[model samples]
Target chain A: MKKHPLDDYLRVARMPHIWCPGCGLGLVVNCFLRGLLRSQLNLDKVVIVSGIGCTGRAAGYINLDSFHTTHGRAVPFATGLKVANPELEVVVISGDGDLVAIGGNHLIHAARRNTDLTVLCVNNFVYGMTGGQMGPTTPLTARTTTSRGGSVDRPFNIPHLAAASGAAYVARWTTAHVRRLEKAVTEALLKKGFSLVEIVSPCPTYYGRMNKQVTGLDQMKYFRDNSVIKSGIDPKGVGIEVNGPIVVGKFIDRG
Target chain B: MPEREYLAGEFFLSGDDACAEGAISAGCRFFAGYPITPATEIAERMSERLPEVGGNYIQMEDELGSMAAVLGASWAGTKAMTATSGPGFSLMMENIGLGIMTETPCVVVNIQRGGPSTGLPTLTGQGDMMQARWGSHGPYSIIALSPSSPQELYDLTIRAFNLSEKYRLPVLVMSEAATGHMYEKVVIPPSGEIELLARRKPTVPPEAYLPFAPDTDLVPPMANAGEGYRLHVTGLTHDERGYPAMTVEAQDRLVRRLVDKIERNKADIIALEEDGTGDAEVVICSYGVSARVSQIAVERARGEGIRVGLLRLITVWPFPDDRVRELARQVKAFVVPEINYGQIALEVERCACGLAKVVLVPHMGGRVHAPELILEAVRQAAR
Candidate 1:
C-alpha cells in the first residue's frame, strides 16, 4: 500500500505506532485530515486535542498543536482553547471510554456551550490501549476486561447524545464508509457551534474477539454488511436490530 | 495626566456591570464562566454585554467547565477570562496548569470570599491570595493582583488581561467580594486610555511557524486554532515543540524554562505602592482590603508619632521578594496584615529573611483587619 499522502505529524512519525493494524483509528485520522484539507482550513489554526485511549494517539500523530490530556478531559480542555482564542479551529478526537465515560460531563457542557468546536469520537467499542476493557459505548451483551459477564448496561446513542446536548451538527459513520465519514467531517467542521462525528471504528485486537469477529478485514465487512445508508433522513427513524444494517449518515444538522 | 476626549462611550452598569464592559474595553471577546457569588455579577455582566460587542459569552455548567471553555476560547484565538470565588478557583486550578504548560494567554478572577471550603458564600475576604499563586498542581509561574476598590477592580481587570496577553500566561485579578461588590467612582478610561491586549500573533505565514518555538523575546508568538500552523500543546513534560516528551533530559529543560521565563522577568511583572517608606522604623505590608485599611492605619500611626511605612503589594505573586527585602533592610520591623491567617505575612517574613522583625496581623473568615489592630502590631514591633 502506498503512503496515503497525509502529512506525517512531524513529532511522532517514526514509531512503531502503538495502534493495532486492524484498528480503524488511523483511517478516521486520515479522513479528518482530508476534511481539513478539503475545507482549506489553515493548519496553523487547527488544534487537535484528545483524551487517553487509542484515539488519543491523534495528539501525537496530527501535525498540529495537539493536546494529549487527562482521560476524558479533552472536551473541557478544548473548550478552554476555543474560548481563549476563538479564531482557532479546535477539533477534539477521542475514544469511547474517553468521551462517553470519564469525559461525559465536559462533552455535554461543550455541547451546551455550542462552543464552535468539533468532537470526533472514534468508537472502537471497548478500551483498546490497556487491553480490551468494556467501554461505555460497548454493547451490553459483549464480554471484556471489566464486564466478563457481558456489559449489562446499555450503551449511549452518541448521535442522540450530541443532538440533545445541543450540538449544531451531529453525525455517525464507520471506517468502511471513508468518503462518507470525510464528508460528514467536512460538514461538521463547516457548521457553526458544537459539532460531533462518531466513527464506528474496528478494534480487531480487542472488541473483535468478544463479538466473535476475527480480523480487521472482517470487522470492516461486518460494518459494510450491517450499515444501511440513509441520506437526508432522521437517524431516529432507523432501528438498531439484530442482523440489520447499522444506519450510517448525518443524523441531525441543527445548524 | 493629559486631558483627552477618548472613548467616552456609555452603557448601563452593574457591579458585575463594569467588569464585563471593562473586559471588552481590554479586548476580551471570549468569556467562559460558571455562576458563583460576588463573582456571578461578572458572569452576568459578560453574558449580557459580550453579545452587544459581537463577542462570545458562555455560561459553562460549572467552574471547571468555565475554565476549560475559556482556555479553548483562548486557543482558538481570543482574549478570554472566567470569574469565580474560592471553590471555583480550586476547580479551575487543574486547567490553569494546562494553560501554563501550553503557554496559552488568558485571565482568571477570583472575587474572594472567606473559606476553608465554601466558608462564606457572599461575603468579603482576601483569604484566597496565596491560593491564586499556588493553586495549580505543578511548578509554574503565576501573576496575581489585588484591588481595594471597584475602580481599581475595573482598571486592574483590564490590566490583568493586558499582562496575560503580553506575557503569554494566565494572570489573576484577586478581587475581594467587598471590592467586587462596592460601587465606586470609576473613570472608565476613554477608549484611548483603555489599552487593549490581543495575543502577540505570529507575523509569519502559516507554514513556517513552530507554535512553541521560543523567540528572542522569551515568550513565543502564538497562533490561533484553525490557522493552519498545526501547533501542539500538552500538559505532559515536552520539548519546545509542545509534544509530550517523557525523558530525563526533556523534563529537566522544560521545567527549567517554565520557571526561568517568569523568574528572569520578575522585574517586569512585579508592581507595588510604597507609602511613606522615606523615613521609617516600622514598615507595614498589606494587599487588597487590608491594604486599604493599612493605608489609613499608617496615616493614623504617623499622627501618633510612630515611624511607620506601608508597602501595598499590587502584584501579590512573583512575591515581590526583592522589594520586600529592600524595604525590610530600611525598617526596624515588617508588620504584615491580611484577611487570611497569615498567607502573605509568612511570605513577607521569608522574603525579609531576618533583615527585619516580621509580625503578622491576621483576621480570619469574613472579617476585615482593622487599621488600629495593624497599627498596634506596628507599635509592638517597634518596641
Candidate 2:
C-alpha cells in the first residue's frame, strides 16, 4: 500500500475517518483525488458539495473548496454555486437518501438543465448514516430497521434515473470495483454536461447487521462476485437478480 | 420613454413604478417574481419594461423560485430583484438565508400586507417588520426600509443596491399597498450619470480568492462567475476559507461577525424622518402606508393647535429607536399607527420603554386609516 499525497486544502483534524475498516468511502475519496490530480485543473477552482449523511461528511474531509449545506438542498446550493461561478467545476457527493429522496427536485432540475456538474451518489441501499432507515434506494425484500418484514417497495435504479433526466454521463460501480469507479469519476469530471456516478457502497454496522449479509469484507467480496461487467447491457436490469445481471459499466455516455 | 426632467432630470412616478424604473436604470439584467396584491405592479411593470432595456423578466414557479433565480443572476454578476406580498414573503425565507449565508448581493422587495398568515393581501400592513429581522433560522442581519411615497421608493431602491454592494448582503425594500399602489410625484434616480455600485472584483489572484474571506471593513471582495475565480459558497457555518466548520469556537466567531457588522454600524445603516417635534406634547411613530395617513393626522391635529410630532421610519429594521426615545423625553405620549393590529407599534413600545405612555392606532385588511381615525387616537393620547 503506497502512501497517499496530502494537501493543505484537505482537512486532517477530522480524520482518520469514522467509517469502519473496509468501508468504500475512502476509495471514493482517493479516486476523487486521483481524478482531481490527473487533470491540471486549478485545484482552487473546483467545489465539492455534500448533503447530510455518511457521504455528506465528505465535504469536511476534501482538499478543495467545499460546502456542507442543509439536507436535500445541496443540489440547489451547488446549482447556485455553479450558476454564480460557471468557471469553477462543481461536484456534488450525496448519499441516496440525501439526493434521491429529499433533494430530488434539485437532482431532476440540474439534470434537465444539464448544468455542468458531477453528482456522485453513494447508494448503500439503506440510510446507513441515520441508523438504517428505509431509503428510496433500499432494495426490495432487503432488511432494514424500518422495513423489518422484508421491504415491499422497489429501489430506484439511479443510473437510469440520471439517463432519464438527460444527464450526459451515467455510470454504476460497487465498492469492490474501485479501479472502474476511478475511471468513471475521471470521465464524469472531464465531461461537459451533468454527470452522475452511482456507487454501491457497504454499510457494515446498519445494513450488514440487519441483512443476513456477511461483514464488510465479505460484503465487498459478494459485490465483486455478484456484479456483471457488461460491454452492453441495461443498467436497470443489473441489481435485483433473478431480475437480470447486476451490470456494472458505463451505461450512458451522450458525450 | 425619453428621460423626463423636473427639478432637473427627475420625473413624477408612483412608488411601485419608481421601484421598477429604478431597477431598470440600475442595469438590472434579471427580474423574477410571482404577482401578489400591492406588490404585483412592481412585477407587472418589470415584465413590460425589462425587455425594452434588453434584460430578462421571468414569472417564476413561486416565490421560492423567484428568490432562487435572483440569487442565480447575482452569481452571474447581474443585478437582480423580486417583489412579493406577505404570504409570498414567508415562502421566500429559507432562500433568503441561502442568500445571506452565501453572501450573494441582490434586492428583495416585500410590499407588506396585513398578516399572521394571509391577513390582507390587498391592503397595507407592516406586520412582517420583525419577521424580516428574525425570519431565517440562523443568525443574520438585514437592511429593510419603509418608503412613505413614490419618490422615497425610487430613491431608496437605489440606496438598497448601494448598501448591498457595499456590505455584500441582501437588502430589502419594505413597501406597502398604500405606498406601492398610491400615485405620487416621483423623480427617478439618474442611471447613466449617477454612480452605480459595480459588482466587487477579486483583489487576490484567482487562486487565492477565498469567496467568504474578510479583508478590511469586514466585507470580502467578491468575484463573478465568468471572471475566472473559482468560488465554493455554502449556507453552512464556514471558516475564513469558506470551508464548513461545526466547532463551537468557529461557530461563535462566525456568528459574532455576522451580527456585529450590522449592530456596530446601525447608526450608519439606520435612517428616519421627523416632523414638528419642537415642544410637542404627543409624538407619533409610524412607517409604510400608515405613515402617510399619520402625516395628514399630525397636520390636522396641529391645525387644531395640538402640540404633536411625527417620526416616519424610513429604515424599519434598525427601528428608529434613538430618535423615538429622544422625542419620548419631551413628549407626554408616543402614538403608533399601522395597518396591522400593532406590529411596529410593539417595536416602538420596546424602544420607548417607560419614557412615555404609548398609543396604538390599528387598522387591518384592505382598509386604509383615515385622518379622522388616527386623529382620534391622537386626540385621546393628547388628553
Which candidate ranks first by TM-score, i.e. highest?
A: 1
Task: Give per-model CA RMSD.
Answer: 4.0, 4.1
True contacts kept of each: 0.74, 0.23
lDDT of 2 at B195: 62
Report DockQ per prediction, comma-separated: 0.54, 0.27
For model 2, the docking class works out as acceptable
Error of 1 at B335 (Å): 2.3
Question: TM-score, B chain, candidate 1?
Answer: 0.94
CAPRI quality level assigned to candidate 1 from its DockQ score: medium
Q: Give the C-alpha miss distance for residue B311 in model 2, angstroms.
A: 1.0
Tens digits of per-residue lDDT, candidate 1, B262-373, equal 8788888888898788888999888887888888889888888998988888888888888888887788999888888889988888988888998988888576776789
Can you list the residue pairs that collide in candidate 2?
A: A85-B225, A238-A246, B12-B186
Candidate 1's displacement at residue A215, Å, is 5.7
